[model samples]
Target: MHSQNNDKKIIKKFNESESLVINEFDKSGIISFAQKDVSNSFLRGTSNDFIEESTLYWTMKFNKYANDFFKKLTSDKYNFNQGMLKVFKNDMYEENNSKNYLLINSADDIKEMTNCHLIPILKNIIHAPKEDMGLLAESLVHMTLLKRKFSIDQEETVGGAIVVVIISKSDGFIWKEKKQYYSNESNKHLEYVNYYKSQ
Candidate 1:
């Protein structure tokens, strides 16, 4: 309950701290790609809008399990099961008409899994440094393919991956936006050394 003059000073300071500036020189770019033929592997990947929507809609319902998966991968601390993921199309997570849910299985079911399992790759991408995102995405996908003994150049198998990296101002400003797509179908692998490579 300070004087109005103090409140004015606080307001002024807050406004000065709120710096959002965008001009014609600003640009935004999305770098992403995916492998071809998604039916051959026990894993699946998606990125960009699909991932964004899922992150927003699922929130904790999905993130808690994803965090567990990440912990298991990064550290052997959690005894979480690393098994195939299954997607159910039903509206099971209908809290206020929200449709988002995930179910996990035991580790014993890993080998016989025939469906395209969803990896905790999104958690990795979400927590990755902004500059390392592109290479990280490609590297993770390539590594997964290597695990299946798939060629990086041939046999577009059922295993696929997509990673979306968007470059923009750290303060959240946009003037121009661009998207570049790379995939096995196009014979292009999505690899960028830095944030500005796509820009």
Candidate 2:
């Protein structure tokens, strides 16, 4: 996890979950944000009731990060719904039984799930890994299969390595751009890109 000290960023990287932690410097405001940089558009819908909004934002961010990572390199891991970004405010969804995919609208309800996270129950992943136990290998294979079908991690059995690389680079660029935006916060959205950097 990442935290801040005297305003400088502190980074903590995790290999198991590919998760990162960043802090706000006060020490306790630590959130579970991913490695991707947070933007003002993040606060776009953040309202007086921030809990739900933040939860939704977190969920959407992960989906978008995953989607964008595969897309930048023209990798096949880009899941189909990612292309739907132009038309919707969010792009996360889940499926129930066969032939019926339920679109998840409640972002804060972690229990309901996006419905996408239910692979082991909905689909049997029995033969995923040849080098490990059936369950772990099966699960990995299942996830890898999704990554493959999504066209995320190609060129190896991992399924989504390339996507992660793409997300990291894009996120870094985003941080640079975000820093520029905060440097000049008074400007309107249309031309903040140029004016923000000047300050």
Per-residue CA lDDT of model 2 for 115-192, tens digit only, reads 233323223323332223223323434454454466543433344332211112212222221234232344455364
- Total backbone collisions for each predicted model: 5, 10
lDDT of each: 0.36, 0.31
Model 2 clash pairs? 2-21, 2-22, 76-150, 76-151, 77-150, 77-151, 77-152, 78-150, 153-159, 153-160
Runs of candidate 1 exceeding 4 Å displacement: 1-34, 37-119, 140-166, 171-199
Tens-place lDDT per residue, model 1, 1-199, is 0122432343344323222212223332222234422211223333222332333344444545654555555455645444422122112223222311221111112212311233243344455765465555455566656645665565544355444344545513222222433343543333442245757
Clashes of 2: 10
Q: State residue 75's C-alpha deviation in candidate 1, in Å.
A: 58
87: Cα error in model 1, Å: 34
For each candidate in turn, the TM-score is 0.21, 0.17
Alpha carbon lDDT at 94, candidate 2: 25
